[model samples]
Target chain A: MAVTRPGGPVDGSSPDAVSIAVPERASTGPVVARALRLLEAFSDERPTLTLSEISRRSGVPLSTAHRLVAALETWGAVERDPAGRYQVGLRLWEVGALAPRGPGLRERALPYLEDLCAVTRENVQLAVREDDEIVYVERLAGTQAVGVHIRVGGRWAMTATGVGLVLLAHAPPDVVERVLEGPFTRHTPWTLTDPARIRETLAAVRTRGYAVSERQITSDATSVAAPVRDATGEVVAALSVVAHHGNPPVSVLAPLVRTSAGGVSHALAAGRRPRRPR
Target chain B: MAVTRPGGPVDGSSPDAVSIAVPERASTGPVVARALRLLEAFSDERPTLTLSEISRRSGVPLSTAHRLVAALETWGAVERDPAGRYQVGLRLWEVGALAPRGPGLRERALPYLEDLCAVTRENVQLAVREDDEIVYVERLAGTQAVGVHIRVGGRWAMTATGVGLVLLAHAPPDVVERVLEGPFTRHTPWTLTDPARIRETLAAVRTRGYAVSERQITSDATSVAAPVRDATGEVVAALSVVAHHGNPPVSVLAPLVRTSAGGVSHALAAGRRPRRPR
Candidate 1:
């Protein structure tokens, strides 16, 4: 029986998450790729897994899974639980903390994100683009903030959320054209699936230096977002605040979001090594 | 001419940083271990490195270093920059976010941590014990807080900092014994290196439900700490606030730290899977 997944891996379905474009492996690259794929088998929902479960989920044989897991455990990437199941290790987290776009960015933006969450009592988010999707770097939730389903490192479509739109709007022209072409998944009735409407939204974001996404995920929520720039003025990230729609006008929220984004931009510019664009 | 190599494989005469005890490895495990050793070559002072630099510092053969770096790059544990230097990658950081002792604990405690930082404007820290060393998981810096040279993932002795003392106080008896018997490193004149004094401090922390470490690391700074418990009431982590020793007396800071610790403990207990003892 086909089962539903929260952040499902591609089995030719669930186009809302990151697309799996399996790279051709004629090199040792595929072994490393397969090893990482095995790690992806364990998530926030199923943080611990048995050998068979890992093999089944990753499409690797039981023996292959065992060997890979053993290698990972030895390298301190994966760890074994008392129940003989495997979970992500502390060592992996340590190395991952060094990721420039992940915790490295979160460290600088956190205080400003905290301020945004406090002043508005809303859900504040920081995100960067990864391939065709957006990955949340930091998420700050106020005590009374609307519940958000997004988690750090969780991926979402570039068409759905406020941070996503701000990032997508600032992405290279080719990236914009590619995302505008097709395969947009609708999350709610208000999700902008029409390429023309999305195009208009992107244009507005670029012109006004902010984006407002209304009820894209849930009918009760609206998001206001602004771009965070680096020293060279490249939009390295997007900062956003999501709150209940109709309670406060987007115009009232735009200045706060823009100010927070500016704070993050200044912090990034001050702390990071000079960015030589790829 | 070999300039005095800092952080090299050689043992040092200085008594500051602990001597790295690298196990003799003649096997594949050692090869992997050596590769990881290269990662230790990067520090807070130097977050990026060149290939030749890594080889020289790690004391690995150029070819071996290249092979291992290839493997690390393939796994997305590291990435090369336009300058041909390597830096940590976001994929690794994503996996690191799953670490229960690190981001897992931080994510749960962040809201409470923010509250503490907001109310007190003091430097708040969260730490866990790794062996006998205290590894800071989160540190929220308040604008006017006393300057403390601690960073996330940075390590300190279990005898000095407030969070360190709280963790050391609750550690297993054998771990305590090892620390007490140690040729302890001293930071300031006021640091408590005497085993009996440490014992008394631990007893006080247990009895009084909080710890006040005064002038341990810096002469101008004092820290107030409290233990954070899981659902089973076992001490899982420690939360502390660092401030100038004079104002905001330890007595005042004690209650704030304890209250924030309680809030974090509640949030941790409410999680789907409370962290099991490591």
Candidate 2:
């Protein structure tokens, strides 16, 4: 949850070396940047698309999308399906596994995450904060667990889900204020919409060391979550468990979430965490 | 996997488009290709690197590495770590999740994968064949279980792991022949390097509907695996459970792997399989 990349140099120069050539103000200078955005347009909801579809989604012209997508395919960033639609490529996945905030975080929390699912027989999830939303990195589903739409690398509002709340509670004040400013997606009647109520819930999470969310993302689910910290004591992620509503009090799940979170923290500090070998 | 891309149009372009782009090969084509190669230099083991390290590893000149890293960072394929080293970026991971053989496979197998972990309390893994190697798509750890270094999106030799054996068994004959003919990586004393012995193991896996690898990768661990099929009844993935070598009888874990693999096959056929939502 703590990962944030500062803007770096745009030209191929030293970190301290500024660009001298005329800066292209129109955002069309680097071919690679355009290529990445085209790839980004394909998300969990829209993993496959036709040529024109990608062009429209990425706001690149058909000619440019053609060129960029070709470059991407050469590097194995984009692949085509049997239906001749394009999706992300395996090569990109191989490289993405190197990202510390994504698979790196998942590797560390996995054992404890599994234990939480086994002990509670509920859906266990791990997420990191990206901007104002939380991106799920890993999840373990119980056979009888309630349905959830969240997927690994999928995004959800920071005010609705249990992991989102825990991460947001520990987020900076500016981020909290930004989320309180509106455009919340309402999934169930129980989902908090009032900024004041969410503020109170954040304070409660800080006081109790966990967050309880009832039917916030789905009508039949309840979630409990706790913050996971790194070696420097910074909250880096959140571990959560979602179960069927009315099955047990959210308080029953608090201990499992907290213990798993602490276990993940210890694993991270011990450097025995799961990681894709280089 | 018979998933090779044609050499002409690296993008999702028609053959006609390839004919039109023949002239540009004389110009700055190396820049884009070199940049892609630079990004490829980062891996699970070498997640962070300095400028000279990247140049040395990618075999690109210092100026080229400088230019390419700048292009990558501008496009968010890479980012600078706090200590001024370069690391893979989150944007890359987001796009990588679109790989049909990577997270795409994991999404469909996650529920069944979780069940396998819960019932066995052993390390559960889901993997697909990538070239001659097995690329792990998902791995669910067990609490107090045997320790392992495998993580999601990691790769291992086809002759050295239970999942690898299942995949090699179901692969086309040519794929099998190619693997057996090449030099193999032997991780431990139990790793099968002799072509004849590996052929016998593959045959056994096919006949029994499961695979048992004893201390193949690690001396203290044993793994049992089964094949997962798609609607076409093609062996698209393999599921495995790694445990302490002497803890569970191979006979006991065999049925567990088959049963779980069966559930996953049924789910895939139904098209309602639980997966990462993307």
Candidate 3:
């Protein structure tokens, strides 16, 4: 699993990229970072953990984990279930929902995404590039649509999905190079593994104003994706609809996806306001 | 503004209830708790803040705030924007989305929520009780529907909204009592301020299996809400739809709201799995 910090370099030296690279070695950062490491231990695979399990996974001492967990529990950053296992808390989610690049983007794109889902009756997704990876901000599963492995807040590689290709197309050159230098995992027989071929796909996404992923993630599904630009015309996100392959040609879905993406872009542009620097 | 900790008490002592009652005095809890206080400083009103602003709001010294912010930035719990102001990071949202009482519940209930929104063509919301307050987990705005002040991850008093009434009706006695002890801020002239009336409303909610908040939050809008239960029959969340008042009487909306709530309850019951006690 490649750890990519989404919003480019946080500082001049890109301290986030460095810290995420070596998460287990705790001697380099402050106590707060060590406590945050405990949070990182809980993921989709492991949503809940006991104190000792948290300590083991976070590489913190049992006593330290206990104290930190207590603090987290007190602040509503974490909570204990009926069986005394700690999980992320709703308060933390409320705070996290304020993230401009995450729920904020999802909130704005949701109506258009809903429209797409309603019209196509297919899986509609909105995603953004985080480092070299794609983080799904919102995924609306159509009632009659094929099942997808993607979930809100889930991450995927840049080489395997339509939204990923659209995002990678507009990403920085360094980000593209870093993604291309990958130990890419193939999900299906049609999954592209060659960097040259992936690069060509990205170019096509930029040229055609949309990307079509044919049975790349699963043998039964295909995705059509378009870029969502911000007020500054930067491709901040990608909107896509995944349907059962061969039922509707890519051309059939392309215009709808592009129009939906354009709606989101226009909304973003209209809603863009000057942020007052503190 | 009132500060409420959602999700009841995590510890036997219920330190969260006490700590949130006084968020400014940070000298009382662990260092990690103090650090989380900084996060509490960022809200819908002030989504981004400078280090000095955080220090001022959280009552942490400038140096301590700097160190903790850096730690948060390194761990992607917080990020500095282009103007050197700190905001909640996408990584935090990803972790927070794993909260069962938050996004987990929302994820299971979304399809039904969408259905409710599509059928009603009104604003639909899903929320859970966090202590004595309501934390909106998801909200879908209907096209051509009346504007709503609520946003995803936003909070409201348990006495003023339909979802809040449903959640409060099923809340523990202590939680209810604590909420009634409040100096409730009236959003509109119709907003209930008397504790006795609010208590009666809660009782009605429990009896009827639904709640109708008429012109409480806004003079022109009405909300009908019902409780969503988990596998153990615990009312873990509330579902509601806000519409223009008088157009659809509360009776007309109650059955639809209740049906949507039942759908989510059934989904949750079906998805329930035995947990491994840690």
Candidate 4:
């Protein structure tokens, strides 16, 4: 009989929630890669794991998993509960908070994101592209707004959300091509899967300075997104607002999302510039 | 001449911004500890560092630093920029988001935090104690609220702020004793320095189920804090609201803080209890 883990994805079926691709190890030695694989084993769906579960998920021998996990626990990369289950630790979170693309970007954009959420009373999301997928950096829920399945640090396909579209549109040609290739998961009937249509949508996003995703992820919600640029004018992130479908036209939200994105870009540029000499 | 790194503390001076303690090695081999030390070298003041700088700050030999940094880069724990400066990478941030005591707690407490900030128009902070220091997990700044220096993942002394006092008050006796034996830095004239006074304050915090810090961290701010308990009734976190001095009496904020904390406690309890069989 197969042992079942509480939150593990069922066999032969992808988890319908946030879909994050585990980072592939490059030239790192096997020991380091194995340690990282252990870290990757914990996810939004399965935040805690037993030693045997970690060994199985990471594809490391049980003894190796035990040794690596012991090191990780010592270094505070992972913590063990009273019941001996392992989860990521606070020290790792503190170091990760220094990531320029993660908390740093979110910190610079938060005031504007809060402003957008307050003004529209809708869900505001900030995301950046990692590989071909979009990783949500921050999300502010509008208290009484439409329920959203997305969470911070969650990942989704580039064809299924407004932020994803904006990021894919500004991504390099190779990345765009890679994402537009076959094998897309269809979240809803409205999710854009046709390569030609997705290409056309990317072009329109470039022309309009924003993207509108209508009932792509869920039937009751629509999202509008715009690109956030850095000092070099490269689009580094995407900002979006998801609201109840048909309550406000996409045209109405486009300007708000664009303005917020611009505000974030300006803040980023200002922060990057050196102070003038006295 | 001493070579100064960007984020290293100046002679006899503390970096007043974010203070994150480096994790100590716990009987793990020296290599893992050394890699963790390299990560600890990056801070809010110096988010990016050159290879030589990392070597110097972490006190690792250049060849070993290069090897370990290469591994870290491969594992996406660190990333290099065009200028060859290394910073914390997005993959690590994604993993860190799984920490139960960090983003997990913050995610559950955010809506209530937003509501408190909306109603009070004050700086709201959620924090948990790690070792003897207070690590801020979330801080929601109200528009037009008093400016605050605390950031998420930043650490502060257990005697310095409202949330810190609440957490310290409920902490184990040895931890409290360790904090009280400190050569405390006085940020303001009103900061409590006498151990007797601090003990009284702790007792008062326990009795009242709240704490009020008047001009402790900054002269212009007054903070009211309450404890957040888990399902087991353990004080796992603290919630606080910092406002401009003299704007609202501590009495007015105390009840609000306690209520929001209770709401969070209830939410945590509800989340932890096993669901009844359908």
- Model 3: lDDT of residue A82: 64
Question: For residues A40-99, could you state the per-residue lDDT of candidate 1 as single tens digits?
Answer: 887777878898999999997675566567767877777775457888876677667667
Clashing pairs in 2: A1-A236, A70-B11, A278-B44, A278-B45, B107-B275, B107-B276, B108-B275
Error of 1 at A268 (Å): 3.4
Q: Which of candidates 1 and 3 reaches a greater DockQ?
A: 3
Give the range where candidate 1 chain B is weakest over 10 consecutive residues by summed lDDT: B1-10
Q: In order, what DockQ does each candidate have?
A: 0.17, 0.26, 0.26, 0.22
What C-alpha lDDT do the candidate models reach, one value each?
0.77, 0.78, 0.81, 0.82
True-vs-predicted CA distance for residue B118, candidate 2, Å: 6.2
Total clashing pairs for each candidate: 3, 7, 5, 0
What is the lDDT, from 0 to 100, of the residue B64 in candidate 4?
A: 60
TM-score of 2: 0.74
Model 1, position A259: C-alpha lDDT score? 100
Candidate 3 per-residue lDDT, tens place, B1-278, comes to 12324311111122222212221112113446667888988987787898999999998767656766776887888987656789999999999988988888877887899899999888899999898799889888876477688777888898899999999899999998999999889889999999999988998988999999999978899999999998889898999999899777888889999999999999999965333111
User: Which pairs clash (backbone N, Cα, C closer than 3 Å) in model 4?
Assistant: none
Between candidates 3 and 4, the lDDT winner? 4
Tens digits of per-residue lDDT for model 1, B1-278: 11123211112223332333221111223334555666766665666789888888888656556766777787767787545788776767776777777777887897789899999998899998877888889888886799887778878898888998899889999999999997787889999989999999999999999989999888999999999998778898999999998679987899999999999999877867543211
Return the DockQ of model 2. 0.26
TM-score of each: 0.78, 0.74, 0.82, 0.84
**Model 3 ranges with Cα > 4 A deviation:** A1-28, A271-278, B1-29, B118-121, B142-147, B271-278
Clashing pairs in 3: A6-A130, A6-A131, B6-B130, B6-B131, B7-B130
